[model samples]
Each structure stands twice: as C-alpha cells, then as structure tokens.
Target: MEVSTSKELQAFGETSIEKIIEELREECEIEKHLPGGGYLHMSDELPYLVIYRNEDEDIEKGMDRATVRLILSEASFLIIGNKDFEGYQRLMFCLSEAMSSKFKSFLIIEVFAGDPESRKFKIKGPAGKLSTTIKVLQEQLDDVDSGYRALQLGETEVQDTLQRQPEGKKPLLDLPQLKDSGCLLLGVEVPPVYRSKEGEDYPVFFRSFKDDFVVALHKTIFHFIRIQTSSGVKSYRALGQKHLQEKVKEIDRQLAEIETSYEFLWLVSPANIRHIKDTFFETNYEQVLNYHYRLLPFDPDVLKRRLYNLKLEDVDDPALSYIFREKREELDLQISMLSERGSDSFFYNSMMLFGKISNDLQREAETILKEVNEKEDQDFKSIMKAEDFKILANREFDYFREQDKNFSSKVHVREDVNILMVSRGELYLPSDYKLNANETHALIQHEIGTHVLTYYNGQQQPLKLLSIGLTDYDTLQEGLAVLSEYLVGGLTANRMRTLAGRVVAASARMHGADFQEIFRLLNKDYNFTPQRAFNITSRIMQGGGFTKDISYLKGLVQLKKHLEEGGELAPLLSGKFALEHMPIINELKERRVLTPVKLTPRYLKSEETRKKLGKIREGIPLSQLINA
Candidate 1:
C-alpha cells in the first residue's frame, strides 16, 4: 500500500484521525536517531498497519489467540514512548479516537503512582487537551462506570508495585492491566513536574478520565509512546513559548515580592537610631590606604571589569534600579562623610583598636611561631632569627592563612600592600583571643553557633537576597554572635574593654583623626602597642569610613540588654529572620511564627559615653552576662 504523503495529511483539517496517525508515524521516525529511540519502530508500524487493515481479526481469532498479537506487541513500544506530555497527549487522542469508532466498548485504567494532582505536565494545556480526548472517547464508548472501577484497581496495583521497588531505583511500570478487558496506563510523574505549583490542574483531568474505553485508550496510547517521551528529555526544552512567557512572569513576581519585603523592612527598622549614632566617628589618614585595600581586595581594574560585566547599573526595572543607585550613593556618601570629618572623631580610635587587636593577636601568634622556630622552623628562617617586627608580620601571614583557606597571595593579597586581608569569616586572637575550654565553647557559640548557624539557616531559605546578607543584618548578626559568647560564659572584662576600645576608636574616627594621631593616642593613652594602634587605626580609616568599628561594643550592649530582659534567641536564628528586614519578621510574628525582632543602635543618645562611664564607675566590668 502507498503511504500517505505529508500534503495529504495536512489537508485533513489538521485534526483528522488519518492525518494525526500519519504525522505520528513521521515524527516517530524522525525521533529515532536523536538519542533514545522514538515510538513506532518498523516492527510496531507493520503490526499497526496489519491491525488497521483487518480490524475484524479479533472477532475471527478471539481476544486470547489472534494474528494481531504481533501488532499489539509492537504497539506497546509506541505506548511506552508516550511517557512525555506532548507524546502522551497526541497518542491518547489518536487511540481514543480510534477505539471510540472501532470498538463497542473499551476500558482504560490510568494509574499515576503519586498524587495525580501533583503529576501535572509542565506543558500548559496538556491536562485539558488530554481530558478533551478522554471525554470524546468516553462519550463514544458510553461505559464511564466500568472505566472508573478499572482506574481504581489500576491505581492500587501501581502503588503496590512501586512500593516494592528498591529505594532510589525507578519502577519499571506503575501497574499492569489486561488490555480490551481493562487497559492500564501506569507511571510515576517526574519529580520536577510533580513538585511544580502548576500541578494543581492535574486532578481535574485525572477525574475526567475515570472510566471505560477512554481509560483503555489512555493506557494504549501511553504504552505505545512511553519510551519516546521520557520526562527528562522533555522538561527544560519542551516548554512552549506560552509556558516560557508564564515562567518569566513568575520570576518577575518573585523579584517583586523580594523588593516589597525589603522596602517594608526598611520602613520599620530603626534607621533614625543608626543616623543619630553615626555622628561621632573620625577618619584616620595613614591607615586609610590599608583600610581601603583591606575591605576591597580586588584591584580597581578587576573590579571595573566585573562591574561592567555585571551591568548591575543597567537594570531595567525602575524599583531595582533605584535600589542599586541608592546603595552606590550610600557607599559614596559614607566615603565622603568620613573624608570630610576632621581628626577629632573615632577614625584614630578605630585605628587604635585595629592596632591593639592586631598586635595582641600577633603576640600570641609570635609565641607559637617562636616554638616552631626553636623546633621544625629551621627550613625557613626561625622566628628567633627574625626581628620582632618580622616575627609579627610572619604571624599575621600565618594567622590570615589559617583563617581563610581560599586566601591566595596572588589574587586576594598583593605583595605591594605588605598586609594580608580576609573579606569573610570572623577574625579573632588566642590569648585575649584564644579560648580556654570554656572560652572555646563560647567562641563556638558566638562564631559557629550564632554567625555560621544563622548563615547556613538563611541559606536554607528560598530567597537569595536573604542568604546573601541584608543591609542591617550586620547589627543583629554581631549582636547575636556576642550574645552567644555571653550565653556560653565567654564574656569577660578584657572582652568588654576590647569592645569599648573599638567604640572609642570608631568615635575618634568620626571626629577625623589621622592614622598617626590615632596610633599615638592608642599607644600613649589606651596602652596599646604602636603596631596594634596602627592596625586598628588603619582598619577604621582605610575604607574611607569607620562603620565596622562601632558595631562591636554597640552590638554587645544591645545583646546584653536583650538577654537581661529575657528575650528569646531562637527567633533570631530562623531562616527567614533578618534584622534589616524587620517588617517581614513582624509579619511572621503576626502570623504566629517566631522571627528576629528589629535591631536598633545602642548609642542613640549619649549612650556610648554613658556605657563607658558606667563601666569605669562600677569597676565590675562593662560586659555583664544576664544570667550571671
């Protein structure tokens, strides 16, 4: 017999049974060479042709032993290939149409292993299209009740069979049913489609096809095309233009949600307190270069290249553009503000704090380096062989290396700068820094327990912005890190002093002291070494601002007050919790979920001076553990 031409098929109103079958045949042949072979192999096509030619073969030979058995076997391959949504829909329509016209009655049992509602195709209109085909078949067959019973039985069997499969292994088939007596289409939905929000539409389609020859037709069609239409091959690319458009809309919605949440938080957070507390810090001059280099390790050239590539400034959405511009402006304003302030502020104070912290850490590191120098340190110059300054420098290098595994001398740290810097992770020393067993526990509670725990937990959330860190999240993070230290019994007088020194330095920078002045004051008045004073002053003045310096004492004081008032800490650790994003927290709290409360600056009034004076007068130490 002459095969139908493509022209002839197209002429059949694009929906004629003969035309669809012919198109299916052509499509199947084309799909064969493309990876996993398609439905309608030569053997299956031959049987299909024979069955079409002699529909009376079943009546003549009986259902059990018929010449059409070869064709039925071949047809099974086509059904298997229809596992994909498009293939499944096409095959179901074809078979349902064929059965409705040819058979007196037929039964179909579609057994979806998972929830049918959850097994929807990502392709739009698939469920509806398939349901229409099933309705056409059901109306023609007039055996809806029998079809429903068969469907239930098939579903049960499929569930039972799937339960027996080994964990992680795919079940070969969901369920098996007798064709003609009861045809069954059984399979598990692909995980992506199963979990997708679009899945809500699937139950309606599943229910529509609940009985008789429409079910049988669904089974036959699925059996025939399963192999060709695997979900893996169809998921990412098979999406129609309409579906892609819908996805774009969905992405926009999510972005809107994030922005709205951010705005709401901004409105509710204690912005006034931060602005008022910002008045004291002074900038340091000598450490200014170091501070700038430390905060931003990447070279200007490299940063420019990345910024150009990111096109972050070119964002089209007005709201997002506004936010981007605002952030840049804020950073620039901060830099300008620090530069404009004279030497009276905490810039020098911060420099002093950095110098003290660095020197103190360096001293501890030197002790260890000396031991290494006395023993295995012969390969390299011994710590004893080096001058004190050289020993301190080496200690700094080693300490930075131990802290950041990804630290590279080439890209991250420049030899020209003569300093090692780390952008991420907490930095601490061992003596005034090294934790004893109890202190170690406190450090863990502070570092890993508070900071890292919140970080990882935030990562578990759906929003990338939350995980990336919010604008004012620093205040809460530091406060909580300090609180955890207090809870674990690690808060001490020395720690309080260190924190106070940070505040004093930060305040001095706000008053515009240069690095030399800050270093001298810290060394002469505060009893910090020259090196320690230099490091601290550099940290405060270098980044063109002293933002980080103020947080240490302020965060600790706030945490102390909170804990003293019996505030719960668990809400602060929630995945969705954010200090900057306070309105969302309020919303969550309103909904009866635990969430972090808004964090306000500790020194809104002459709060810093008050705390400092209180510490001096009490002689009981600045940091007071609430429990103690």
Candidate 2:
C-alpha cells in the first residue's frame, strides 16, 4: 500500500517512478506483496538490491527455490521480484533512480538459474566496482563444494544488463537513456546445484545449498553496505528479519496451543500404579497387566490436522523458523504416541519420540549400575515424608516468585502422582512417598531448583516455546536436573542406580522383552528389589512401553560429554533447550531474540556444590559425582 508514510502505490509499474522516488527521501523499510506472485522487501532503506525475475521459464522448474529462500529470509539488502520483462525493467529503473537520488550510488544484483550441469557461478557485471562482490561470492562457492565448481567473472555494460530478458525476446530499457542513472547492476547466474537428473528439483539438496547461497549473499550485501551505502549496520547476521512478524508469533501461539492441548505423559500414564503393582506382585510378575489411562481430552486426528496446517514457511526469521519447524515435528510424534497408547504400535512411536537406547547409553547405564551397588538403598534410612518435601518445594518456588512477579510455579502434594515429579512448572508429590535426609534436599533441587527454575526462566522469554521446550529438551533438561541433585549434596549411590535401572529396562523393552521379561531383568539381573524393579518396569511399560525413563541416564551421559568438552551450565539455565541447539541458541542470544534467564538453581550457590560442579567440568565421571 504505502511505500513511504505519505506516498501510496496500489500497483508496481513504470508510471510510479517519480512518486516512489519521492518516498525514498527518508530512511524506511519497504514491503509489498504484489499481484502475480511477486514481492518487494527491504530490511531498511539500503543501497543494494537483489532482483529475481519471476517470468524466467527456468524458475517454474523449481531450480531457484534455494535462491528464493535466500531472498525471502529477509537479507539486509532491498529485494524486488517481478513476473514480466517490461514491468521488471520498469521497476528496476525506478529503484535505480530513487536509490541513486537518495544515496548518490547503488548496487543491484539479479539472480537467475544456469544450466543444471554448469557446476559454476557466472557473474556478469561492470568490471571495476563489482569485483569485490564477485570475489566474495566466488570464494563462498568453493566453500559449498569440495573443488568441482568455479566462479566465472565477466564484464557487461549497464544498459545491456538491464535490457536482457529470457528467450532473447527484446531489450526493455533504452540503452542511451539509462546509462547514466548511477546504479551498477550485476547479473549473477547461480547454477542449480539442487537440480536432479529428471530435471525435477531435489528438495533435499536445496537445504544443503540454501545456507551457502545465504552466506555468500549476505557477505556481498555487507560489503556493499560498508563500502557503498550509508547504512550503519555491521554484521550480516544483524541483517534480515530483525523484527518478528505477526505470522511468526501466531504460529508460535498456535504451536503452544497444540502443545498444551494434551498432557501426553500424564494421559498415557496408569491412574492406578499402586493398585496394579499389588496385583502384579500377587501374580509373581508373570501376567501382562492391562494398565488403565486417563480419557483423551482432544481428538488426536483433529489436533494433528491443525498441527500440519500451521505452515512454518510463513515464518520469516531463520532462527525462529528452524526452531519452530523442529518443535512441530516433535509434537507430531508426541501426539501420535497418545493414539498408539497400550498397543504394540506405541513402542515404535515411543522409540521415535524418546529415541532408542544406544550402546553408549547402555554401557554408561550398566557402568553406573556396577559402580553403585544396589545394596546402597538399604543402607540409607528414609527420613522425610511427602508433606515435608512439598513445604520445601513451595519455599523454593516462592523464592523465585519474589524476584519476578510473573514466576507462577506452584507445588502440590497429590494422591494421584506416583512419586516426585514436575509437570507444567508445578512440583507434584505422591502422598505415600518418603525421602531420606539427603534425598529431601536433592529432590528439592531436582524438582524445584532445576525443573521449576527453568520453567519460570523460560516464561520470562517472549518466545513461549522456550518455557514449553525445544525439541528433545527432556534429555538435556533431565540430565541437568539430575546434576542439580548432585550439586546440592543430595545425589546418592541408590539414586544413580535408579537412573541406571531405567536405561536397562528401556533397552530390554526395545529389544522385544515383554513386561514380565523386563521386570525380571531389573529384579534378577540388576538386583533391584521386586518392588523397585516392578515400579521401574511398570513406569517404562506405561502406554505400551514408554521409554522416556532412559532419558534420565542417557541425558547424564550426554551432559558429561558436553561438560568434558568444556561447556558451561549457566546459559543452559536460560530456558529448556537440547544440548545440540547451543549454536542456534547462541545466535538467537546474539540477535537479542531471547531474554536473559530470570532464575538459576540455588544449588550452584553452595561452596561444596560449586566444587563438585567444577570437578564435573574437569571431566570427572558422572558416577563419581555420588562420592563428590
């Protein structure tokens, strides 16, 4: 609609040049979604522009989708696309005149696809000022491929570059009239690296090449801005989609809505764990008990349809887009798990959702089991009840709440919950559960200090996804929470063995071990008591073999790997995130898209706990944490 605060242009054509030129007087970001599928976008008033002619026949073949993605990603430069030669040339003349009038100089780069087998980028532009961009783009090409592609630099006259169109039709702009407009144009012929054999586009390779194209494009734009334009922006990453669009927020809200739609674990869990275990013990762990579950709150099919319809492509920011897409995929598996509850199909879905127990996970779990003898459980006297634990947990929750009024985490003692757990930022306690003296402080740190703390910290962030979680955050979060138990002088040899027993049970179940078989493996092989083994096996076998229990130890294994490589624990406390997502988190952090964490565990404040954490950082084995 409005190009400037005052000037309005309903359509894009040659006649609007003077009016558009008037709007370019002051600095402004321009955006127009045009007729015939063309779009004009600018991060801010800029001297350089990336142009794509939608009329190109090769564009319809999906060869330029990567280039298209690079354009739409909101790179710092002014970007304009058009569907016809006449209109495209006219729009360029307007841009050149307006940009030259404002900044006294301008750079324009037109991108088009080359032959499928070209295996090279050809830059056709003026020789003098274009060399820097040509050189940078050429250098980046080498980074994309091993050594097969080349960058070909060629010279072209200004009028010739602007006038050229597909199919050798005719020149659209007058050569003599436009030569002195003071804007340099570069026609960049990008080879379709993603083009497949049947001339169809290979969508997979497009992602591989998208980053390479974006990197080169941004560097070229950065150089153009630094050397040519009056723009004060510095980093290329600082360019492109600085503001989060409503579409992104809407998608985020919808994603959060669907995520909150069903409490997956709570629904899939058996309502009568204590009752079933009594029956299981009576049968001598021989029968495959039918576990009852909570009624489904929403239609799985309806929620899945809603999930698929929320298009991620509508999101502009690259960092948010990637994270949102990943969350969406994880939600699909989680929702599918609910539908597959109490069936054989559920285990496969569990594997997809929770991941298989790898050999390394198994070895680490087995190693922990061996290091911490099961007899340790009998040695420690259980001293604290669920009521005492709830009081301390509520105090911990209140401690954070005092710092931030928005910290709304609560603690509850419920008869329904089987043991200590945190769901939806609230600590839940099983009324009958008892804790030893050390277990009291450790469980407090584990449930409230870490889990509740991260929830509130994530809530402080504008992106609700952080508070909810990133994909596969359970492993990282659980590992970090388990570590909190150790940091607070609470992690016990028996506690560590409990985590190990989970991994063994999950592994057994995944390898076709039935409920009774897995129960026997934990009771007979791991030497866990009949009650403890039944509890572990029943927990894992809930919802037709939920394997999330494995995350407790598997996460610790990965956390140790992360710490051994010298990663810190503070940034992780900012919100719930997977260990592998540090780079994106760092990027979003640098971009100021995320808020600084509001809360960290109080465990880190203790002199002894800090000492143990320091030892963990120095590569001490996780099992050694018990002795620490």
- Tell me the alpha-carbon RMSD of every candidate: 21.3, 5.7
lDDT tens digits, residue span 1-628, model 2: 2332333344666556544444444435555554345566653356767766554444455335556665666533333333454665676677776666677676676666766666666666544546676666666655555432343422221222444333353433455534666676666666676766456666655654665576677777777778766666566665555445668878988988899888777888889887888888787777655888888999889999999999886554557777888999999988888887889888898898878878888888898888877655534456778787777877887778677767776667788887677777877888888867788888888878778888878877777888789899999999998988888777888888889999998888888998889888888888898878888888898988898888888888888788778888788888888998888777666545676777767766678876776788788876788888
- CA error at residue 98 for candidate 2, angstroms: 12
Angstrom error of the Cα, residue 387, model 2: value is 2.2
- The list of candidate 2 runs beyond 4 A from truth reads 1-68, 75-77, 81-109, 114-119, 125-133, 145-187, 192-212, 219-237, 283-288, 313-318, 375-382, 605-609
**lDDT score at residue 41, model 2, on the 0-100 scale:** 64
* Over 4 Å off, model 1: 1-439, 529-535, 563-566, 575-580, 588-622
What are the TM-scores, per candidate, against the unseen true structure? 0.34, 0.80
TM-score of 2: 0.80
- Tens digits of per-residue lDDT for model 1 on 451-570? 544544444343333443544455567676665555445655444444555555655655666656766766677665454455565555533445465555555544445545555445
**What Cα-based lDDT does every candidate model obtain?**
0.35, 0.72
